[model samples]
Target: MRTGLLLTTLALGLSTTALPASAETLHLFGPFKDEHGATAPIKGSASAMLDTTKNTLTYRFEDNGLSGPVTAAHLHGPAADGQDAGVLAPIDGPYTTRMTGTLQLTPEQVKEVQAGQSYINLHTEKYPDGEARAQLTTDLTGHKHHME
Candidate 1:
């Protein structure tokens, strides 16, 4: 009986270790305007799931009322809102109003995202600078928020 109990305990421990870590869902949104530095009337929202254990980021973003067709999109980071930073990841696009993709990030990139220094920018033909933008952040509940 003691031997059987020991085997059960060992199996339980191994199973626990094999389980994947919990994923974090990040909420993102933006109301594009010229005041926030956009030259157009674009508006949009986005959401992302970060799987720390797998070092992967999956995201979905959608926007409308762009001044022109979306030419590019990117995850730019290590900067705060009202600031600009270089692109950390490029989003594949010929996007009209929506885009979705997954990316593998380095440890440093993950850290930046967790620290709320990352942002998403959708670029349009008329505004190569950026037609819509939002900064990623976490609220008091530790839930992520993508703020304009």
Candidate 2:
């Protein structure tokens, strides 16, 4: 009986260790540029963290020396760098030097983000096309599940 109990306890411990974590944290960052197929002096940077289990994204961004007031911002994707696509998520702002927020994403959106095809873009009064843009890439500095 004592041996049987010890074996059962060991088995339980092994099983628990093999269980997957409930949530995963993913990080992304980018450097912005003019992606409207034009040349501009505008510049910016952005970073974000996604909690896969909660389907929430927390992001912060900053820009400087834009030619005009920022009219809009968004996460746009399913396209490669230098390519343009429709907005995936709109970011509310008369943007300041820094902006931050947390947003919930649909399962489909999350999939697109994880696929490395999404980008952040800032539209300005002078460049209704988009004065600054950044392609978001997975940080990969920590553990992340393979999206395959």
- Tell me, by TM-score, which candidate is best: 2
| Model 1 misplaced stretches (Cα beyond 4 Å) | 1-16, 20-37, 140-148
State the lDDT of candidate 2 residue by residue for 68-125, as single tens digits. 7789988887787788888888888757868888777887887777777788888887
Q: Mind giving the per-residue lDDT tens digits that candidate 1 earns over 1-148?
A: 9999999999999988876676455544333333245555556666666666666667777677777777888888999877889998988766757667897888788878777787788777677888677666654343333432
User: What 10-residue stretch in candidate 1 is worst by lDDT?
Assistant: 139-148
Q: List the residue pairs that clash in candidate 2.
A: 33-133
Candidate 2: list runs displaced more than 4 Å. 1-22, 139-148
How does model 2 score by TM-score? Answer: 0.75
Candidates in order, TM-scores: namely: 0.71, 0.75
